[model samples]
Target: MNKLRIGAATAAVLLALGTAAWSLRASGAGHTDASAPAPSVLTVEVIVPQQQSWPQSVQASGSITPWQEIIVSPETGGLRIAELLVDVGAVVKRGQLLARLADDSLQADLRKQQAAVAQAQANLYQAMSNLQRARMVDGSGALSAQKMEEYRIAEATSRASLDSARADLDSTRLKLSQTRIVAVDDGVVSSKSGVLGNVVAAGTELYRLVRQGKVEWRPELDARQVSTVHTGQSARLTLPGGEQVAGQVRLVAPTLSATTGRATVYVSLPAGAARAGMFANGTIELGAQPALTLPQSAIVMRDGRAYVYLVGSGSQVTSRAVSTGRRHGDRIEVLSGVDASARVVASGGAFLSDGARVTVASVGSAS
Candidate 1:
């Protein structure tokens, strides 16, 4: 009976230990099943392309220049500049004196011409008296026909000499007036080449005037772009110092440059808006056009090409290459790629890959 009882105790102890081992194994398996991680999904915001009234424009870079540069030169030669009334950057009006030349010689010539006129008049009066006296003695043999002819010829000659002297006097007066250099039009002087007491010749440049103080922008464009631009188009430019100026197209070059294959488009700006020879960047307004645009953050650049992410039916994103156009503010023009109805990843596009699974964030969720 004791041996049988011991055998039963051993069997019961083994069965208890086996049951405990099985229970521990099942508990471990259950814990592992509950703690397993799920697949990762990137939460992102989505947007749809919309139609907006974006103004059409062409971007160009060029330099500022004077609209009309007038070269001021002396009309009379062999005269010295006695005084310079205007210097560089001096504003002047029409017919304003800019410089003065010595006029003493001209005044002296005027007096000499006047004295010659007086002598010629006196000779003319004597000849006229002789002719009159001869005519009174006609048919009386007091004067010969040849003598009367001589008196008439002398009177005509003296009258001609007097007219010549008057002409010389007028020329002298004109030269005297020319000694006073004056501005041709209202303008601001840009450069000065005349020096005080310096003798200058006729047609020599004395000063350079920016006519009307008007400045313009001259931007070069390719053959294709030149065809689209026309005169009277609205333009806006940013100066070198960040000042904005509005302007209008003044002229479009009829012919392109043979060497560079480019043409210049002239845009007229207001006076004092910008200085000549300044580099500027501007846009030519080409009217309004409907554009399908998206936020700039929605587009991503890779390998020099542009791309955008498109959401698919299965909550997955696929990258699509796109061609872009002009950019306005924070938005960019989508020339071709996805349709207007397609949902696109608005931001965080740089971190996304092709065919990546994504979770759409709620509209009111904090990004």
Candidate 2:
């Protein structure tokens, strides 16, 4: 019975020892699994910087206006419009008759004035002969001094009346000449205010004249852009319907407009079929500028800020803030925050983190 109990106790002790050893091995395996390092993963591409040409530019918008405009008006009152010789849009030369006024009464008055002038001339000749006779009588003492002086005064008064009548006749003739409305310059009639039998007063507007065939394109540019525009600068204009016309800058405004913060730039187009009020768009060439340019894909924006990823040694990338200027075709001008020696990431910058490991691929290689 003692041997049996002793054998049972020994078997229990061996079983307990085996269980403890298994627990220790399991804990050791767990520790080994926990201590193992994680795998490092990164994918990247090589970047290079190159010099590129850039253009200095300023953008603006404006409307087209006429170069010259003239308003024609009637010069005399009580003139009835008889005939409109030229209609709106008719080309006319300087001093060409545009309209006629009913001057029948004026003509009658002119003829009466001419008859009066002839009668006055006859009176003037008679008065001169009487004056000479009166002077001769005064010298011969055949007339009293008072009577002779009175006769001489009468002759002088008659001469003065004749001269006054002649001047009045000439003035009436001049007024009759003005009854014909004439163009003061070579131009097209843009507007007409005349109608048959409509009486017009002096200075009543008759027609609006615009110089024919020549039109000016006046474009407004901002004050900052105005400085870059020079006389004779080449400009390309895009009209309605996508028609392109080339011209040169003929004039620039000397003062800036306080209301619009802009000034006018006049572009003189070549002779063609263009009207004064045609809508147009144009671009003027400013001078060129040197700039650090990079592909547009290399730039990224975050939190309303622009940045580019720069690759350093060991295939590491660092995010750098940048100031940008004008954008060209497929590239952007870097105003600051990048040097020619730094390698800017051209793609896949959104997935990158600072200090992350990376594998740099060559050009044309898959990322």
Consecutive 10-residue window with the lowest summed lDDT within model 2:
358-367
Top candidate on TM-score is: 1
Using alpha carbons, what is the TM-score of model 2?
A: 0.71
| TM-score for candidate 1 | 0.82
lDDT, candidate 2, 171-272, per-residue tens: 888888888889888887778877778898988888888765466678898877898899988787787778877777899999999998889888887645
Per-prediction CA RMSD (Å): 4.6, 7.2
What would the TM-scores of all predictions be? 0.82, 0.71
Task: Residues 1-367, candidate 1: write the lDDT tens digits.
Answer: 9999999999999999999999999999999988964343688888888788888788899998899998988888998889989889899999999989888888999899989889988988998898888889977998888988998999899889889988988898898899988988999999999888998999888899999999999999998888888899999999888989999999999999999999999999999999988999999998889988888998999999999998887778899999998788899999999788878998888998987888888432111
Which segments of model 2 are wrong by more than 4 Å?
1-55, 217-237, 245-274, 277-286, 297-311, 314-319, 345-367
How many collisions per candidate? 0, 0
